[model samples]
Target: MQSSSFLAAILFFISAAFASDSVHKYQPDDAVDLWVNKVGPFRNPQETYNYYSLPFCHPSGDAAHKRRGLGEVLGGNELIDSQIDIKFQKPVGKTTICEIELDEAQVMQFKEAIDRDYLFEFFMDDLPLWGYVGDFHSKRKGDNQHMLFTHKSITVKYNKNHIIEVRLTQQNPKPLEVGRKLDMTYSVRWIPTNITFARRFDVYLDYPFFESQIHWFSIYNSLMMMFLAGLVSTILMRTLRNDYAKYAREDDDLETLERDASEESGWKLVHGDVFRTPFSIALLSALVGTGAQLAMLILLVILFAPVGMLYIGRGAIVTTFIVCYAFTSFISGYVSGGMYSQHGGKNWIKSMILTASLFPFMCFGIGFILNTVAIFYGSLAAIPFGTMVVVFVIWAFVSFPLALLGSVVGRNWSGAPNNPCRIKTIPRPIPEKNWYLKPSVVSIVGGLLPFGSVSIEMYFVFTSFWNYRVYYTYGFMLLIFLILLIVTVCVTIIGTYFLLNVENYHWQWTSFCSAASTSVYVFLYSIYYYCMKTTMSGFFQTSFYFGHTLMFCLGLGILCGATGYLGSNLFVRRIYRNIKCD
Candidate 1:
């Protein structure tokens, strides 16, 4: 049987080569060559030809490996050309690779019947975005089968012309198939960074949102988180930037001087009372770290998928969760501390304690409840109970103390640089309002709006992650992600603007309030989402539910908080740009 299969494969390759090679060399024919042609639906005894885009699903019922019907495959909008196009850059060694485009309908009718069930699902949950995924591996066919992945490489440009070209030392190659299913497997030689997925000032609609959110979240939240430690970093910089007080008639002149002076001041803008703000450091740490963590998770998937660690199987989220947690701890410490320092906050020790403590407590507490149910159901272990204890023990005993240790050290080490943002206090006996309407409480509520928008979509995202469903909609998820980022910034901006309008601007710390405020709504939305969408059973299911599900939802909350905080801070800075600070 093996010998027969091998012989048949050889015959098929020869036949495909003879048929395609006779065709025209559309563009500089000798410059590129058609190297391979392979068919799939491997289970069907009869050989047949087929093609489909990856993230191509396995057929339902018994239709597996069945060549798509000619009428259907050929029909417009019927998903006709399901294929992974492996466009070559430079032919490696002596191998030449080129396209063999055909009416997929014609090919289906031309072949013998076969099962149509073979397929592989692509995922974005554990990975980053790929410009294009196609199936084809390369090597030198003639003389010395050397690895051709090195040196002879090309950049993959998406949304470009059909004439995808690969430059090589111009050589002819044999025909072959890299993957049996319609999946695109790119080579290491392919460089994604060099090629702009955009041209003439446009990116995939998702790119703008990604850049906006990442940049906005990183910068502005640091400013908001500083509110608790209580030094308006902008204020501190102004005092330092204009140690000799001066007034300006126009905004641009003052803005220019401040920007230049700020650079020279050498005082990092994050300090003081900002660290004391409740939940600021704790949650901001979660967002910044989670963002960074997600980035790594993406790279790990793209760089190492074939090697088998990242998206390997059922245990993938476990690895992701651990990494996420570890990273969050570091970010929490850094963001909280940096902001505290900018506020000239004296409690570095206390700030660190809160940064390391708050998030873990909430995450672990919720995670524990869900994991317990998963264990009771007799499935996978929901993070070993022992591990939970170890985690908390470290948080309380190790992290909390280090924060205290750092706080003591910072207090003894120095004092706030002799400075004065001498805002002559305008004292006003503040009028009171209904508790629900108060700026502090209301702004918090205002913050949760985006979380409300996202909860519906989030349920499916996690279920797919835990249940081992192949999620191929990453390209779309990337789009949705962009929108959410915009929505987050908008929410934060509006919320902070409303608060500044109130007399209680004293509580400016809640600028992160927009994002943090949304967390409450997120929790509530999940309650509804869970009841409406899932019918989960067993501890394995529930633990997976808690481990995978809540993390995403809550982590999403953190993302909002960070985004909102940043947005509001910038708004404040822009508005107060001309306000006197000395």
Candidate 2:
């Protein structure tokens, strides 16, 4: 009797596993619907696209009228085209959710599909925004490839002239188990009037990533900032007290000066030539100019992001970046020209040209290579030709002339008191340094501290970029950015003081290198992130990842390098100005 009972229980469970389908019919009162396409990882199986839905659903009513803009001339809009509708049999059962079958001619559109590793995206008001998600990995035994399926319950209806309308109810408690029937229903009393789905997407999907796990990162960065601040403060106080006493005695009398002359060591000895401009002054000036421009752009972006100025629409932030960068060209030329002239550079025109060309040349050269790869792969991520032309036009007409005008103004007021001590015609012999005091050793060690301060936050940034997730916590990001700047400047100042103590006065590049080497750490961390954190694969993904990152690092190197150099220069000037150097 016990054995019979066990057999009956097993039969009951099996019957429950294969339950019958329960279809939820489409309702007219539903506010909005998004029909999902085949879902897969960044690297999907070739057949996945062949089987996914063709270009069926598009704007039919008022939506097409509203989404039109001047940018529509660039020609990526599919909603503007006549609707190509095809009819297929009504999906039969719950098993029908497992596949979306399209014929050969219909499948040709899929052939030219952009190779985005995204799992799912839907068109809202003719703009494709990422929100939908689905299981891509095959479940069948012995099958080793990504599979496509309907993640949510979808209801289909045929309209006039082959147009098809879909009412898609989101799947609840996702990744439905193999055994049970999957049925879902979504209700809306009124339709969403927003042109883009960004707002709704942010509320539903993006908020969780930003809010969760940020507390730990915040705590870590805050502690680092406090530690660095305290360390710098202590050093500043001790150094100032000692230096003041010695300099005060020097100005008192000949007897007091003679007694303290032998004891005068470290940075005081280098005061005579501390402000003497180093070689490649023009390039250094340009770097500093460009860095300042970028720093301002970043600062404004961070401040604006929290205020929602740059967060309103698709590509708004990018547009802000481009426009701000262009307008900031004058600042770059003005600063570079002023610094160069102070350092005894004669040709103001050359300084302007160098400052204006440095950033754009590097950016466009690297960008073109990466964009070519994107285009070859049919990726929508590639910048359009028209957009590139617009960028170029902005650079040529607005930015270049502004740079020239600023340079002319900078040269007019370039006669600032740059040197604390008069430059001697003959060069002073720089004393040889110990092993730890060498340039290479100092640079490597200098960057590590700053890198540590920002390392935790960088993980989230990379995840947002590579994983196609949303990043909305600009407030936290802004705090971390401030901390990073503080840490970089402080660490560079400390390193500069030490290098000067070792009798090495060539600090222009060393100070820059000391801070800029943080980019090396960032790049290495990116490699580690790629290997461990992401599942992306393919030649295009690999090429784009490393190539684009290299440029990013280069830009950061310039920014941090300039920041560190400027801080060190300020410290050096301040210390030398108060000293009694004969």
How high is the CA lDDT of each candidate model?
A: 0.41, 0.64
lDDT of 1 by residue, 1-582 (tens): 999999999998775553332231122212222221122232311121223322222233443222222222211111121122333333222222223332454234222211133222121111112111112334576432211111122232322222222222212222222332222123313222343322311322234433445434533343343332234334534553463243343234866767675343211221222123334543353344333333334444434433443332323434444444454344445444554554456545555566555555667677667555545543223345455565566556655555445444433443232322332333333345457647667566765545545444454454454332444335334434555555666656555544433334433446555566566676666566556655554334445444544665566656656666656555555544434443
Cα misplacement distance, residue 31 of candidate 2 (Å): 12
Worst 10 residues of 1 by lDDT: 123-132
TM-scores for all candidates: the values are 0.44, 0.75
Candidate 1 backbone overlaps, count: 54
Tell me the deviation in Å of residue 303 in model 1: 9.9
Q: Count the backbone clashes (under 3 Å) in each candidate.
A: 54, 1
Model 2, 157-179: lDDT tens digits are 32211113334454443232333
Q: Root-mean-square deviation of each candidate, in angstroms? A: 19.1, 14.4
- Top candidate (TM-score): 2
The local lDDT score (0 to 100) that residue 270 gets in candidate 1 is: 18
lDDT score of model 1?
0.41
